[model samples]
Target: MRILLALLYVSLVGAPGGSSLPANDSFRNTIQSILNIGQITLFHIKKLRTKLPAAPQMEFSTPSIDGLTSISRDLQILDNELQNPVTDLLSQIQADVSSMEGRVRLFALTMGCPVQARPRGHPWASLFPDSHFYLILEKVQRYLDTIFLNKDKLKVC
Candidate 1:
């Protein structure tokens, strides 16, 4: 599962060594791919909730998944046109998403959380990539934030 996710990320985000962006699906498919990965990650996390240890809730508050619903509804309600400010904000948010995901990757390695494959026809991928990609990516960011903030929740014993 990790390998699958990695391949998808590399395909979409491209290699760090590249001198320029790979020019691969920079607009449409790139957004869709991110959405697909985000949806897949959420589905996997839901399944792993049982397999993984409980996260810390004493000092840090885990982000609520409910946020995604409103974000999604907002996206659906949006007209075909997107505002310049909104697009700019999404780009910045994507950068934060990337950073958060990076931190979570290390914690994921240490936790050794195993991912069960998403069931077939499970709507594991997002539909119609748009600004909603940011919404989905925001969801992924929240999951990563939860994992990174509770990095010590896993025990060796």
Candidate 2:
């Protein structure tokens, strides 16, 4: 998305030789922002769910990357209900996540990290239909944070 491209532009063109910060610091900041966006969206989802109890849950198909395309569609359905901040926040999140995910893939390839299996759908999605989106975001944030902060945890790869 544009957010990811813009950030990449800044990091690549706005800095001398493509970067001012060390790689770890740069990645840490990206991960933090991604988590922050997800946190805000989760907060909004919780607020709406508290009032409406039957608020919708977004589902991703098994094999996360393939299912990722559905996210924009799902978020659009909730747009009218969630409105400004939440919508805007959710809007920002996907780009950030995609960017971070790309970095993770690149890092994995560079380091010869093995590809980990994408999580499958089943009990988690079915059991927590109401909170499934929230759970997915939490897992993503944790995965990115762990990998970014601890290279060895690139067990994430």
Candidates in order have lDDT scores of: 0.39, 0.43
Q: Any residue pairs clashing in model 2, and if so which? A: none
| Stretches > 4 Å off in candidate 2 | 1-89, 114-130, 154-157
Stretches > 4 Å off in candidate 1: 1-117, 121-128
Best-matching candidate per lDDT: 2
Query: What's the TM-score of every candidate structure?
Result: 0.25, 0.32
Please provide, for model 1 over 31-97, each residue's C-alpha lDDT reduced to its tens digit, 9 standing for 90 to 100.
3443454455555545544554554332323343232232222222221112223334334333434
lDDT of 2 by residue, 1-157 (tens): 9999999988778677545367667656644553455455445445544654453455444212222223222222223222223234344444545444454444455446644443332222234433644544544444334433443343333
| Backbone atom clashes (below 3 Å) for every candidate | 0, 0
